[model samples]
Target chain A: MNAVVLSPVDLAIAAALIVLLAALSLRLRLGVERQLLVSAARTTVQLLLIALVLKVLFEHAHLHWVALMAAVMILAAGREVSARQKHRLAGWWGYGIGTASMFLSSFTVTVLALLAVIGNDPWYAPQYAIPLLGMVLGNTMNGIALGLDRLTLDAVQRRAVIEARLALGERWQQAIAESRHEAMRVGLIPIINAMAAAGIVSLPGMMTGQILAGAPPLEAAKYQILVMFLIAGGTGLGTLVAVSLAARRLFDERHRLRPERVGSRP
Target chain B: MPVLELDALATRHVGPLDLRIDAGECVCLQGPSGSGKSLLLRALADLDPHAGEVRLDGVACSAMPAPQWRRRVVLVAAESQWWHARVGAHFPPGFDPAQLSAVDLPPAALDWEVVRCSTGERQRLALLRALALQPAALLLDEPTGNLDAGSCAAVEALIAAYRHAHAAAVLWVSHDARQAARVAQRCLTLHDGRFMAGVPAAEAPA
Candidate 1:
């Protein structure tokens, strides 16, 4: 049987809880009341807009439409990734690296899952392709953002050490090896934690949604496992690519540690 | 022929200057703060973007790989940095602890944590680290700036010995006229982004 659908009134009741949270925040002088309200409004508006777009997307189910939606999602994720950095590489490099890395990792994994694992007819079916790409891209974006932020920040803070190493005849890769490894570890941390705490500590959001939407529990669990593996692989690959590109950008071809290449947010 | 040569090298604030240091010679550079003494040294080491050319032993810096170029021409900045916890970890593999005595450092300094070393100790150790590379040329930016009188003398003697033994070309940056005279064969002062011959050591104002 299909799951019960919630009307606008039901969602409004949920939205009221957020308003109540804002009121409590205001009373407590938490200074987040305005942000809380604004964010809640943003969530409602953004999700609803996407819902409408997805309706049109599902009805068309054309390859080009699916590809266009995927491109928009990847671009938005790229912007978010760069925006999260405290010190980003100057110029298009800051945005381009993260966008390209996420595209390579997320798109490849989603397409592979569709064609080989899920084997959906046409292999680009909106029903399977969209959600799969969304999950992988979203998680990869977070990893890449964290990884790039850590890489740039560390490069700036530890400029002296890196230069000292460089001055001592170490190759660019050798000089930046530690910072790159640290960035990778930080990027993988969220997925590692999620995997460790899955099942016993909490049901993943996707699995819960599937179960609520009337999928059998076993099927939902299987899909969750698949998605988790896909996400882990995507995040790892994306972070690796983004961090490598960013670390290279921190230096010039001459192997100089050009921290000036990374500019602080104005 | 000069072992280390700078021909019209220029950085943002320092440049278009020419100089040469023959093998086994020490040339000290002096300048007022902000007059680009450090910038000149950085350029010599190829640690900063600069215009013009530098050569070691008639070999242009651009001719070799950067790391190879740097390995033969090392820069030890005024402030030393230690990335590893233990002092010895910063040194190259198979480094002899016996060399520490030449810098007046105890053999046990190698076992000490980097944080435990005083500024002067780190400075001396940094020099030893650079010297261990057996660089054909050395770029020293106030190598003894953080040291006491005794430590300074020790560093000078060690550097002098290293130069003598290896016949390395040394470009030493110093603010103290007396130290410059003591360590350098000839001294050049950077003023308004140009190098002028410094006063003879005896004629220099005390």
Candidate 2:
């Protein structure tokens, strides 16, 4: 089986569908006509740019280029995490926690999968390493961001309760234990939902994409399962690291509650 | 010797005043709401950012680790905070069951969920919790504010017993003049950031 290729005329036919959607949105005054058009344009440009870049990187097959791209993706994800936070640590600490957690979790999981599971030739194949790391980083980043944000916000809002524990000679770690637990629970929720719904409530994107590319159903299912497991592990690890680091930042060396260290969303 | 000493301790518009409480001394502190009375207690507890010095038994609060200082000088705020769902979970290991009974709380009070506790129960239970730490000094911020007169008297007696037994320095914040006179050996009123030796005249506002 071979995947179908689209010519310029074939693309025009798809573009016509988008135009109809935008026209209907305009007629109904849904107030999203401009957003729909802009999103369509952005989707086209971004995908094409990434496709071209990936093609070059795959052809050259250089480890340095693959590493650079992964670093860039991690950095962007880190910034997104920081931006999405409602309560965040001051200065670069906000971004640092997310970036460090994602880099550590995604890198370790991706490398382990490549070396032990896939065993691609040269092991650093751009095709496998880049896509796998990207998916892992995306999920892990959201988990870290959510966990850190919840931990910080909860600490600030529950200042009296936390300090009450501290007054009773509880260590800083002991005082914030409940909040940390809650944050981790919140962070892992998305991944848990996806795991629950996958292959039953809906077909996952990767499996569908693989089937579209003519891979056997069973082969695609196997890959999807591996990817899901990697994502869950990466997200859980990242969320835990992020919450721990963020919790440490909320208190000072003196065991005093330092709500000043946490800042409202900018 | 003084058990707790405040040498010109000052916070944002609160104090630059000196005071001393000898061991076993119960000094009642009265001030209007938002008069920085709570802030002063927090400063003494080293829970707030402040200047000057607070010494506990000749050891400077700054010199010791915060947890160490806090363990010795415990501050019970007006609003008690319950971290764990259950009451017993808040206390340290080896917490004497008798402490709960002493505060007029049932021994099974420990088994009740914190959310089910009445405000007065929390206030009294918080005092018991603080006393369990065996602090060298106790800072009470309207600890019995939510309790009825009977419960208030019971809590007062419990605190007096603890102070008598441990010789803990006490700074109890109270708005009621009668309660203050009944509970404290001496009274100190806060007005314009100064701690006056006796209650201020009615014309003098805090």
Candidate 3:
């Protein structure tokens, strides 16, 4: 089969349409719709642009581009997610957690899926590396954002118990432990909910994509398992980065919960 | 014995509120509704920002980290509202929330789903969680405010047990003078964002 490609015109039109749709939804005060739409559109535009660049990049097989792309994606994802969660963006952990998560998940999936399974050449395969990493990093971004939001909100709601913990001589980290768990639950809930609703309520994008790409049902089923594992890996890594890594930010220099940063939407 | 001093604490429509409760003592705060009886305690805990200091064990709470300060100073509400998802899920490993049963909380409460808890159950559960932590000072914002007379007395006894076991000072805020007298060794009446400790010993919790 001829390699599938999105023409630049088609890509641009899709991007413009998505932006318009997001704007309209935002105007309607449908925040969740706006969040999903904007994220999807941004991901689409970003992936398509990177695809074009990677096509040229693969021809050269330069290691610098691969490393640079990974770094850029990590920073970009971290920054956007931290920005999205705004006030709750706790310290430098966002960077560490985001980077660690993307590396652990994307590389793990890449290694497992390719070396152990497909047996593809490991030397600079843009096709597998870029797309798969994007999926991992993108979902991780959302996880971090959601975790931060929930954690901070929990801090507010669970103030009494948290303070009680502190009064018992528990350190700031320990005091917020239960609250952090709440945030983790909040962060992890979507994946669990999605898993629950998977297949019956909705066909997940990955499984559907594999099916549409002309893979046989069993082959697609295998891919689905792999994707699910990767997603699980990514979610775990993301939650760690978001919850623990965000720890430094939750407590101030004196280990007290700082008043949240002003001017946050989340 | 340590004391909790809310020093010149003021917030929007709240306080310039000031008072102190020594270690192993109970100080009651009385005020009409919207008079910031609860708000004062919330501000002292630094859950909300206010202009003032909360001193504990002779250390200026403002200077100490809020989390550190909070760990030493706990607040229990009348209807303890901070209960989490599952009663058991909310507690960490090994703080046997089972002991809450002595306080009229169910033994199974530690495992009961949080969403199913009634208002009174939530209050008791929050208290249990706080007591489990064994704070140095307990700030009770009318912890029995929602219960009936008999239930209120039962909660008071539970608190008495908690305080005796821990030797923790208690600052109990209430609208009832009789309840205040029963629960607190000393009472501080709040009016117009300030406190009148009434008598010298009222500054001390027994």
Chain B TM, per prediction: 0.96, 0.93, 0.87
Model 3 misplaced stretches (Cα beyond 4 Å): A1-51, A79-122, A125-128, A138-232, A251-266, B2-25, B32-36, B39-73, B82-136, B150-168, B178-187, B191-206
Clashing pairs in 2: none
Model 3 interface DockQ? 0.23
Best of the candidates, DockQ: 1
lDDT of 1 by residue, B1-206 (tens): 33999989999978798988999999888888888988888888888999999999999998888999899999999999999999999998999999999878889999999998999999999999999999999999999999998888889999999899899999998889888878887888899788877665555554
Model 1 gets an lDDT of 0.92
lDDT at A142, model 3: 74
State the DockQ of every prediction.
0.84, 0.67, 0.23
Q: What is residue A107's positional error in candidate 1, in angstroms?
A: 0.5
How accurate locally is residue A93 in candidate 1, as Cα lDDT from 0 to 100?
97
The fnat scores of all predictions, in order, read 0.78, 0.60, 0.33
Model 1 residue A121 CA deviation in Å? 0.3
Interface RMSDs of the predictions, in order, are: 0.7, 1.2, 4.3
Across all candidates, the chain A TM-score values are: 0.97, 0.96, 0.73
Over A26-57, each residue of candidate 2 has an lDDT whose tens digit, in order, gives 89998888898899999999999999999999
- What is the alpha-carbon lDDT of model 3 when measured against the actual structure? 0.69
